[model samples]
Target: MHTNLSSLNAAIAGKTEAEALAVLADLFPGEVVFSTSLGYEDQVITDLIYLNNINVKVFTLDTGRLFNETYLTLQKTNNRYDTKIQVYYPQTAAVEQLVSEKGPLSFYDSLENRKECCFIRKVEPLNRALKGAKIWVTGIRAEQSGNRQDMPQLEWDEAHQLFKFHPILHWSFDKVKEYVKVNNVPYNPLHDRGFVSIGCGPCTRAIREGEDFRAGRWWWEDESKKECGLHAK
Candidate 1:
């Protein structure tokens, strides 16, 4: 880990998103890029990047199984921001190989199968999208999952060979919603319908009140194995 995590903590201790973004811009210069899923927090970060005219590249993983609402949100964000949000897709051969060997819903069979699906649909494409990028920005928040609690705002990603940055690491869900509403940023409509942590269409569902933010994702699996391979540090 090559980041000055302590300095990042101090700089963002009481600062606003705008302040944090400004510092990030100064620190990363031309190497910053924001990866979005178009969720509420991602939308907030997208809005911040747009509003400030940050020169960061914006991209998304268009897993073939994404919800219709997610695609709609992507369209809306492009129209509203007038910026091209690059979409990355998995290699055709890789996807075809997986589907050919094990049917489309193989992820429901076992943990190994699920990880295989994630690797083909998300992780591989994400790795390609981040090629040559120095700073990988995300909307990850600590409260989203138990495993995410110890994440820092800035850290070294040995897997990606770059610095991973979580701009909203300490933000609460309420704070994220407030920022979205206040800024009128475009977001996934599924969020309004109860999908807290939206992912692939077949793997995600709506969560009830008081459930964990990520309860909607991979609800069929054990809580410890809920994550897709994209965000692994």
Candidate 2:
């Protein structure tokens, strides 16, 4: 069951990430999971989990279109932490059907077509990865998007019917970067090259200085259609 954000925040207030992890360790007491995309925020959370020796499971969706740098970071994370990071892939039939019908570049045509691609490649697989989990941990920060600005540090994910926790929800991009640098955590190299929001290869690009943080993702579509449905309400 999802608890109210205020109550959850009060419970975790004044606690460090390590303290929070200890509380989560006792709260769930079994099989807590954290999903990552090898982004800066995710890397910071990954480092916290690793350094604190938290028993939470860390995993990622390998949408089959990730950047080479993302793949390398995944490899490096595994090598450095000496812990297994599970990789989830989309179902073969769903992927084949979308590609076969849309020719893999259908997102260039219309919003519906792009959403169709995202549904098959990301949303569906994420649903599977989250199944049966009591808590869903993410690297979501309020400043990341307008829609996310109102998000709380912890809330019930009514969409997924689980408690959703955002340890760094109030953190700034600079703070996330600082933590990553200070901790020497492994992150995607593309971040340094201007990819603020990384996703699949065809849909993601580098953003300009004045562009929106998410402009690089689905650059062919309007702002409202930027989401891939995983974060949709």
> What are the RMSD figures for all models against the true structure?
2.3, 1.8
Q: Report lDDT per candidate.
A: 0.86, 0.84
Regions of candidate 1 where Cα sits further than 4 Å from its true position: 1-15
State the lDDT of candidate 2 residue by residue for 1-233, as single tens digits.
22456655676789987677656656675647798999998999999888888878888999988889999999999999998898899899988888887787898899889888888888888888888877788889888898888886767788888788789888999999998888888889999999988889999999999998889998987788788888753
lDDT of 1 by residue, 156-217 (tens): 78888887878888999999999899878888989889998888999999999888877888
Q: Estimate candidate 2's alpha-carbon lDDT, on a 0 to 1 scale.
A: 0.84
TM-score for candidate 1, residues paired by index: 0.91
lDDT of 1 at 216: 87
**Model 2 misplacement above 4 A:** 1-7
